[model samples]
Target: MQITKCLHTALLVADLARAEHFYGTVLDLPKAERPLNFLGAWYQVEDYQIHLIVAESVPADLVNSEKLGRNRHLAFSVTDLAAAKDQLLVHGCSIQMSASGRPALFTQDPDGNVIELGETQLA
Candidate 1:
C-alpha cells in the first residue's frame, strides 16, 4: 500500500486552556470545528491539522536534551524567522535557534510539545 498524505498530528496536553492559548492565541493557528465529544481543541495549519487531546499528564521526556529540535516536534513554515522568534518571546515562550545553522527555531508549548518554525518552505 502507498501512503497518500498525513491528515493530522495528535498531541496530548495536560491543560486544555493553556494548550489552546499557545496554539490558538500565540501561534495564531485557526481553530477547526471538532465533533468529538471529548476535552480537546483542533487547529488548522494550511492543509494539515493539529489535534490537542486532553490528558491527565503529559511527560516532558526528551531523547535529546541538548537540542530540543532533535526531539519529537511539529514543524511549520513561516514567512519570517526573526518575527516568529520575536512573537514567541513576547508570549513568554522559550525558543532555541537551530544548532545546525539553519533558518529555523524550536520552541515548546505549555505541555512541553516541541514546535519548529522556519522561513524555508516545507515539502
Candidate 2:
C-alpha cells in the first residue's frame, strides 16, 4: 500500500496537562476535538496533526537524539525562524541549531519528543 499523506503521529506522553500546555501555549498549535472514550488529545501541527496519548513508559531510544542524530523528530515550517526560536526560548525551551546551513532549530517537548522548526520563507 502507498501512503498519500500523514494524517497524524501518535506520541506517548507521561503528563497530559504539561503536554497540552507545551503544544497549545508554547508552540501555539490549536487543539483539535477528539472523540469521547479516546484516551488522548489532538493538536494541529501545521498541515498535519499530532496525537498525544497517555503512556506509562516510552521508548528511550525514540527520545534520545545523541545516539541517532535526531532522526525521529517532527519538523514544522514557520514563517519566521528567529521569532520562533525566541518564542521557544521565552518558554524556557532550549534550542539546538541544525548545522546544515538551513534555517532550522530543534527543541523538545515536556515528554522529550524532539521538534524541529524550519524557516518557510527564504531571505
Candidate 3:
C-alpha cells in the first residue's frame, strides 16, 4: 500500500507552559483543539500540526553538537530568514546558522528539541 502524508509530529516536553510559550507565542503557531485526555498542547501550521506532550523528563542528547542542523530536527519554511533569526534572538532562543551556507538556521525549544527554519519563496 502507498504511504500517506504526515499527520503531525509529537514532541515530549518536560514543561508544558515553557513549550507552549516557544511554539505558540515565540513561533506564532496557532493552537489546535486537543480532544485527547492528556497533558499536552497542539499547534496548527497550515496542513501540519505539532503535538507537545508533557513528560517527566525530556531527552537532550544531541547526535551532532557542532552542527545541530545535521541532527534529528523538524524543519519549517519561513518567508524571511533574517526576521526569523531576530525573532528567535529576541525570545532568548539560541540559534545556529546552517553550515552549508543556505538561508536557514537551527534552534532548540525549552526542552532542547531542535527545529530548523529555512527561507522559502512565496508562490
Please tell me which predicted candidate would have the highest lDDT against the true structure. 3
The best candidate in terms of TM-score: 3
lDDT of 2 by residue, 1-123 (tens): 998998999888988899999999999999998885856789986568899999987665564565323568888889999999999999999888887778899888988888899899767
Residue-level lDDT of model 1, residues 1-123, one tens digit each, is 999999999999999999999999899999999999999999998889999999998998889967998899999999889989999999999999999998999999998889999897556
Residue 70, candidate 3: C-alpha displacement in angstroms: 1.4
Candidate 2 residue pairs in clash (backbone atoms < 3 Å): none
TM-score of 2: 0.87
Please report the TM-score between candidate 3 and the true structure: 0.97
Q: Indicate the worst ten consecutive residues by lDDT in candidate 1.
A: 114-123
Off by over 4 Å in 2: 62-69
- Candidate 1 has a TM-score of 0.95
What TM-scores do the predictions have? 0.95, 0.87, 0.97
lDDT of 3 by residue, 1-119 (tens): 88789889999999999999999989999999999998999999998999999999998889998999878899999999999999999999999999999999999999989999999
lDDT of each: 0.93, 0.84, 0.95
Better of 1 and 2 by lDDT: 1
lDDT rank, highest first? 3, 1, 2
